[model samples]
Target: MKLYTEEWMKILEHIENNDRDYKLFSINYDSNYWFHAKVKGDEVEISNAKFHENSCSIPNPRKISIKEFSLAFPLYKQYTSGVPGIRYKMQKRKIYNSSYIIALIHEIIDDYYFRFSNILNK
Candidate 1:
């Protein structure tokens, strides 16, 4: 179960239900909760991928459709972090849990999507 509910997920579901070709996002999340994916048809990418912990490593970005993008849990955590909702108490007030991180990321991506969609469709 997710730590919190997201209305954006419902919108994504609606998009998928209405279109097939628009459902091929490419984000790759590993066991550690890090992700790496590039927006299709764009040279830019967004990735906070962890190559190898305790070693010199680099992130590998992959191109995926915008429809395939998704947000997952525990947005950020240390090696031995505590429970989800409870851990928020130990951290700073600016960010609480996966909910806050997801919202922030969603807002950023949504902004970029709106900004580019107008140009791409025209």
Candidate 2:
């Protein structure tokens, strides 16, 4: 079984207006930058996407999975309290289950960071 829980999978699968055939996730490095990640079988595809009200389109995604990639999360980043309000609003609108999916995303991010840190010997 995948590391993801059924509830997390439900949140991903519930994206009815995705406009694409796959599950898309947004990773915000901080307020200034973000990127899209979508499931592609065993590996994830990262890309720049143009987001719409309920959908997004990725014209050019990473076609090849990279053997090595590392980006340091900014050490001084601070979470703003306003973000939770925005997310809650989205959740209320049925945009997504931000609470569950955000936790899943955090778990995935934490796992990748540790793996990459070890690989990069940082």
Candidate 3:
């Protein structure tokens, strides 16, 4: 999850700066919060994860219909610098209970999906 966040930050930075004309795609908290981009017909997966869909190619930038280029956002506060969400709190807690931590994770995951969707649409 931490790695996913780092990769996401990179993707977000790229998009925010309009550094690349490539379309950036990030699906958060779907068992895999991954990042990918396509620039000048070349496809690159920022996350070190296997492709989950049919369009997994490089150089050619596998064609992804608008519908296929979907993204999910977080429902709760993201792992922003201002405030670490419940997940971080749990991880830092020395005596956090498993049940409580799992519940917090679920909340965070839902939030992640919401946030991602909101940002992508905007």
Measured by TM-score, the strongest candidate is 2
lDDT of 3 by residue, 2-119 (tens): 1244433443444344432221222233232222333332222222113444322344323322111111123123332224354455345432222221222333233565457658
Give the alpha carbon lDDT tens digit for every residue of 1-122 in model 2.
Answer: 12333333433443322433323334343322234555555334545533434334445664212111111121101111233455445434453323223432443444554446646864
Q: Give per-residue CA lDDT, model 1, range 34-109, as digits (tens).
A: 3332333322233453342332122553332222222233332221233355435424433322332343344333
Q: List the residue pairs that clash in candidate 1.
A: 25-68
Candidate 2 has its poorest 10 consecutive residues by lDDT at: 68-77
Q: Give the TM-score ranking, best first.
A: 2, 1, 3
Rate residue 16 of model 3 by lDDT. Answer: 43
Candidate 2 stretches greater than 4 Å from native:
14-30, 52-122
The C-alpha lDDT values of all candidates are 0.33, 0.35, 0.31
- Clashing residue pairs found in predicted model 2: none
The RMSD of every model to the true structure, in order and in angstroms, is 14.4, 14.1, 15.4
lDDT of 1: 0.33
